[model samples]
Target: MKSNFKFFLAILSVVFVFTACNKYEEGPMLSVLTKKARLTGDWKVEKRISASGDVQLFQTNEVLKINKSGSFDIFVADSLTRFGTWAFAKEKEYVYFTYKKEGVDNIDEFKIIRLKNKELWMEDTEGVQFNYVPA
Candidate 1:
């Protein structure tokens, strides 16, 4: 009876240690909120910087809408209308923006460096980082 009790206690201790270790287990981390359930919401572009070489601050209340189908729409708050339609291409490694009416090919393409907690950092060829916050 004494030997049997000690074996049961040892087994319980092992199980407790394993469960304790898994208690802190977490899921994968994502850079962007790619879920359609959460993406199809209103967002503001906030501010932009022209990173030609130096950081130039461009202030505007621009709004952006990202659809569930990887489609996007951008609007300038001044006119409160769409500036263009943006498509998420190349596994979201690149984005293509095209104006609806102007069609001037005012395309601004950049590589997404990071996305976390509604904050996105995009990098240009010149190594300039554009910080975007959801408005």
Candidate 2:
């Protein structure tokens, strides 16, 4: 009986550790893949929600490709629209993209809301939320 109680306590502790490790606001509870691995993929915009309660759904040919080597590319209708380098900031709570447009450097920071193997959700500084799915 004592050994059984100890085993139950061990399992409970493991469960607590997993639950406490979730860092995103919208979480998967647990994931075996690393954060980078989950973010590196071809993703298409599924929807966008503005701060004023406006929502837009996308059905166009747009894809965001994130590479494991810290590079990223945005393609529209098979044409490259933007290319940049991406990095995790603030202990992986945020993602920063640095790119150039017409000789002007621009950086966009996104706070990760949820990151899973097939889905990604992020919010910008303006409270606009973007949802992405594997493309």
Candidate 3:
């Protein structure tokens, strides 16, 4: 029947249109070759950028120290504070910033763009960029 053939064609057209569309990406996007060993060290935040491209630079004395023992410390001027427990999710390419803040309950995950011995770069889920360098 002509009507039956028309229905089949319509279905086929819809399928092809969907297949032709670009694939959608969900969740944090990270580099394919992010390894954990490059993350341990003392780093200072040289610059930070928001998703909208706003930038912030830190003072020289502030630093983030990541030891091989699994804890992270943040130092601002003369004050040293515990930032959180840190772990690398090799499969997801995210650094898990796990902590129990006074009122909040959840782990923060930052997608790493590049991690090297001298520099570390990451972006939050909101796309804010944090660039670090050896302190």
Candidate 4:
């Protein structure tokens, strides 16, 4: 009887330890990828708006590549010279980006897609939306 009880206690201890270990390993409590985060890849500019509320649609195609390193290269039409680094901020359901260009800071606003199927939207700080068709 003494030997049997010790064996049972050992098994129970092992089971308790395994359960505690498994509880610690419960994957990520939540997904870190947001709709704004889905904007991680290369994107094309469908429209451009100025700070003065001017809108310009490019006659030629423009592309922007966002890298995991937080750097982006902007391709204006056929030119491939403009590039900059970007910073991200998370506030509630909104994600904001700050682009540093030629020593000037360009702050932009973006809205996170609450739904998984919706296309990601980028906006200026004032909430002007930029529809980025993912490349």
Most TM-score-accurate candidate: 2
TM per prediction: 0.50, 0.93, 0.66, 0.50
- Count clashing pairs, candidate 1: 2
**Model 1, range 1-135, lDDT digits (tens) per residue?**
999999999999987876654311121143234523333445654444566555656465776766666566766764546555566556655556566556555666756555445655566656666656676
Model 3 Cα displacement at 25 (Å)? 15
lDDT of 2 at 88: 98
Give the per-residue lDDT digits (tens) of candidate 2, residues 1-135: 999999999999999999998899999888889999999999999999998979999997999999999999999999999999999999999999999999999999999999999999999999999999999
Please, what are the lDDT tens digits per residue for candidate 4 over residues 18-123?
Answer: 6654211222223446533655677775565555668776454777777767777777766775666665555334544566667898755554432122244455
> What value does the lDDT take at residue 80 in candidate 3?
83
Show where candidate 2 strays beyond 4 Å.
none
lDDT for residue 74 in candidate 3, whole number 0-100: 81
Cα error, residue 35 of model 2, in Å, equals 1.0
Comparing 1 with 4 on TM-score, the higher-scoring candidate is 1
Worst 10 residues of 1 by lDDT: 22-31
Clashes of each: 2, 0, 0, 2
Model 3 ranges off by over 4 Å: 1-34, 90-92
Which residue ranges in model 1 land beyond 4 Å of their true spot?
A: 1-41, 45-59, 101-106, 125-127
